[model samples]
Target: MKILLLTLGLGLVCGLQGLDNSAKGSPKLDGKWFTVALASNVTSKIEEGGSLRIFVYNIRVYDGFLTADFFKRENGKCIPFSVTAITKEDGSNLVHYDGLNDFSLESFDDEYSIFMLYNIKDGEVTIWGELFGRTPDLPDEIKKKFEEICERFGIGKDQIRDLYNDDRCEKLR
Candidate 1:
């Protein structure tokens, strides 16, 4: 009985170690990402109609910290802004940009994730999200996952916008 219990304990430890190693190898959110889809329920001047009107992000990860340059689309224009994305805690996969306009990571996979952006002021909270991918397009499976996230967040299907094939920012690259 003692030998069997020891074997079980070793197996559990090995399983946990393998899980941790696999997580380390998961895709890192470091690249030039384009917005593929978006959804939100926030109503503010910044988030007019609760949608990300125009945006693409070039994110760089440095020692677990994140910084990004935003290319905002407007009136047939792509405006630019630079900001730092802060990791909320040690060993936590989520990162965020905390400011007048806050952006946070809700979840991620190999090609894309549901990124949430929000603004809170005057005791009001306004949240928006974008499906950001390394490229302009996402695989069908990834797209489905993003849709699921939107649904779980109570964002209507109609409210989701697909920015995947929009190549307006090609010149910026």
Candidate 2:
């Protein structure tokens, strides 16, 4: 009886260890993700400080492929675009969109995730990135992580606009 109880306890411990490992990894990108902040060619055009930019990304992963839908508000109009993507490699979190856009995983936790996108063309790299969250409002740690990434990418403080207070985007589809 003692040996049986010990064995069961060990199994439970092992199972919980596995669970913890999975839980700490990057948050899944599927479902509606609100943009916390964005640093890109688009955001750099915002001349007004208080003007908020609203964006949302919806991602669906299926059968070794991913489909992403992007919606953004600009000039009092909502623009939408869709692209199909596939994982770059096995066990990699990065996804390649439409063969030109590379959405590479930067960091993620339960509340938020960051993806750095590179638009490669003719030997030039245009860098774009977004800080996405499960909710509209995120904790400070997530914000700091985004700041760190922007700094690392040589995006000046003026270039990193805060879109965290922007309204959530309406569904595009």
Candidate 3:
């Protein structure tokens, strides 16, 4: 009985430790990020004045959740917003926000990351490809890569929107 109890305690400790590590997340992902571009299978969702047309500025992870700081233009004014996504234990970085969001880090380096988001909201599914850069502007090649990714996901070139020069909420920072 004592041996069984000891084994259970050890297992519990190991489980908790794994959870803590997952909560801490990768340091590389915890930092300032700029919204360079956005594309979606549902073009209207990424179009100007769309609900998904948000400019992200920061990302941080804590307690197994990833929170993002961003701004959305409303009534010709920039409105600050924040959303938290619960990181899954499956190591997929999947999170639930306004909907079920499954994020895949398609590509990443020191300066940029392209995330493809599969979201299901209100029974409608949308796939979005987002390009985030360490700087406000990325090279044309990077943009072209993002376009190719979007195309692969059935998002047309016309659906992509460039937001590098639309930092209207910089003052709020």
Candidate 4:
């Protein structure tokens, strides 16, 4: 009984520590962001008028979760959308939107970030490579980096789309 009590106490302490750490939030990832480019194994998902072609306004991280606010152009109208992902203990993010999305931060800095999203819906799996920048326009080198990352994920350059000039959702931005 004493051993069990000690183990329980330790577990509670560890859990609290984790919660406190998570509360500090992902500072580097919390800020205004724009969708610079998108690549997907499923080509249609990143094509024009595709559901994955979204313009991000900002991202907020808090309480072990990250929330993104963005706009999606549908039927010639801009529609606002928000997605929240819980940060797992292992530093992964899980989102439930239109499907179960497992997002992993491939690389990030203050100015740019690349995220890989694995989505499973209706027994179909799709991989998405998303590139975001602090500004709408990204340098050629940054775009090259995104291309390299996409190549690593089996997404060819042809599958990538540059959304820098896409202003359909600019009003919402």
Q: Among all windows of ten consecutive residues in candidate 3, which has the lowest summed lDDT?
A: 8-17
Candidate 2 backbone collisions, by pair: none
Candidate 1, 1-173: lDDT as tens digits: 44532332232211111122125666666677777876766423324222246566677766545667776666666667766744332222222333244444667756775665544445454456678887788888887777676676566666666765555466776
Q: Pick the candidate with the highest lDDT.
A: 4
Write model 3 residue lDDT over 78-136, tens digit each, in one string. 98878876444444445565576666666666678787876767767678878999888
lDDT of 2 by residue, 59-165 (tens): 66555556667765667567776667544322223334322544455676567767666544444445566788887778887788888876776665556666665
The true-versus-predicted C-alpha distance at residue 59 of model 4, in Å, is 0.4
Q: How far is candidate 4 from the true structure (C-alpha RMSD, Å)?
A: 8.7
In model 3, what lDDT does residue 14 have? 19
Clashing pairs in 4: none
Off by more than 4 A, model 4: 1-27, 89-91
Instruction: Report how far off residue 5 is in candidate 2 (Å).
Output: 57
Provide the overall lDDT of each model, using Cα atoms, as 2-decimal numbers. Answer: 0.57, 0.56, 0.71, 0.74
Which model is ahead, 2 or 4, in terms of lDDT?
Answer: 4
Q: Give the residue spans of candidate 2 off by over 4 A.
A: 1-26, 41-54, 88-99, 121-124, 171-173
Candidate 2 local distance difference test against the native: 0.56
Let me know the TM-score candidate 2 reaches against the reference structure: 0.64
**Positional deviation of residue 105's Cα in model 3 after best superposition, in angstroms:** 1.4
